[model samples]
Target: MNFILFFIVACALTFSLFREILKRGSDSILLTVWKFFSYYTTLSNFLVLIWFAALAFLPSSEIGQFAQNANVAAAITFYILTVGIANYLIFGWPKLSVYERISDLSVHAVTPVITFVYWLVFSEKEALQYSLIGYWLIFPISYALYTVVHGKWSRFYPYEFTNVQVLGLKKVALNAIALSISLVIGAASFILLGKTVGRL
Candidate 1:
């Protein structure tokens, strides 16, 4: 299942990225690809692909061992879930071709749900701890910082909330802090759920 999911997500991400690049009609395909990857949605789905691949093919390796950790799995689940929720709440659904829609839904909707279900059924919660949530914040915080710096250079913000040009640095910073708080809360909830499930 992990290996199969890896391919499914990889195809979805690749198709979406290719379509985006085509739509842009940029002379530099590499730059377009870099911009496409700047989106949180793309990054989160890419993380899922990497996680699934690690679990499927390299379970004995160091990275695979890290990927298999319950807290790590839960963090991935949360990040992907945020992708879907943020899309729905902030962007809603945009009109797209059928193929494009399939790619979008695969990465934003199906991937997150299935990832959570997989974690619920297979993850070991015995080692879950509140301290690990701080570690999980590293990826998101780093991404937020990267988005700000990248947007300043390119004048392109992937999401409205992170658009410093219009929203200003103060607003963007506030938005980031708000999101960080929300993630901390969500991470706690996941830990609670995992600990509860582990007991049963």
Candidate 2:
């Protein structure tokens, strides 16, 4: 993983983890810190994803301060224009207006496209080696399970590599297994990691 990318994602993840700390504090100090964080980080997935893409593929710079700002700005821009708008349109702009009827379905529509764009742009064969269990396998399995159970064919499709297999059960099963384990692991390292991380 790129150091810049890792830094921003870790920052974003920290912000996400501390969201309740920001919301529920009662001190001026907490409020000040919260405001600063929210202002500087902007707390957008788009921004973190920009860093992810930069880390995965972009070359390192002697001075990356401007590039860092540019990534966050790009995230804010995309979030406002595309994903944010889609969210508003699908659910209407009421305060927390997520009725069960529309909430699950809309997430299905939104998450995959966003995830796809992020994965397509940022994910690397090398990076996949490190976080394949988190990034690659769990997502496809959960997505397939959700689509199968909910029976809603959102515009997003999981498992792009074997997505075209319209063959019989044997061929589909073979492809599934192949795709699942084709992370090109060196011996039993992933297995050891999987044992420690617990199943995907």
Candidate 3:
């Protein structure tokens, strides 16, 4: 099933990333970027991309989300895997550069933000709420600064956002805002969960 495939890949990626983090100390800019990225995004997304590409055959209802609940459950599992990786990324590795540390920590920023927004949009049918964009907001804003920080052209770009526009700053700004707001919601949700669990 698609769920098992995704979960397994996610587990492997998490383990590999953890081993690399322990070996490398998560200090290098490259490691920081990798850790930041690895924490929040599943390697399975890549697998999903390949699965879709090989779509000479379409999946039956069993392979992927058979219902909205299944989709939510899958997303939650992915988020748990991500956070489990983050526990090590933040506290396990050697103390990192300020940039490395914060960026590495931002792995916690993506899911709840995106999920809450998905709920609002899918259920409430709203058009592009800001809470949907959280850690996602970082890919563009950070990449732009990353380009300037490294003083080179980044392969990353504004187009990754679901809403890209024609050759202007407005598109960038809009995307940034949406992602930022979503990330905030995500952070809040995580903190709330931590508190709830800790208290119980």
Per-candidate RMSD, Å: 1.4, 16.4, 17.3
CA-lDDT, candidates in order: 0.87, 0.39, 0.41
Q: If the candidates were sorted by their lDDT against the true structure, best first, what order would they fall in?
A: 1, 3, 2
lDDT leader: 1
lDDT of 3 at 163: 26
For model 1, where is the 10-residue window of minimal lDDT?
Answer: 18-27
Instruction: Judging by TM-score, tell me the better candidate of 2 and 3.
Output: 3
| Candidate 3 lDDT, 89-171, residue by residue in tens | 54587677665554444333333233333333332121223343343334435544443333223333322442222334576
Candidate 3 wrong stretches, greater than 4 Å: 1-11, 14-144, 147-159, 162-167
Per-residue CA lDDT of model 2 for 1-200, tens digit only, reads 45544454444445543543544556565554544333212333434455455545554662343334422323222332333444455557555423432442333233324433543344331211343333324433443444333322332222232233344446645765774464323213533432343333
Off by over 4 Å in 1: none
Sliding window of 10 residues with minimal summed lDDT for model 2: 123-132
lDDT of 1 by residue, 1-200 (tens): 88888888888888888778777774488888888889888999999999999999999999999999888888898899888887877768999888788877877898888887888889888789998889989999999999898889888887778889999999999999999999999889888988999899
Point to the candidate with the largest TM-score: 1
Better of 1 and 2 by TM-score: 1
Span of 10 residues, lowest total lDDT, candidate 3: 121-130
Given candidate 3, what's the lDDT at residue 166?
Answer: 36
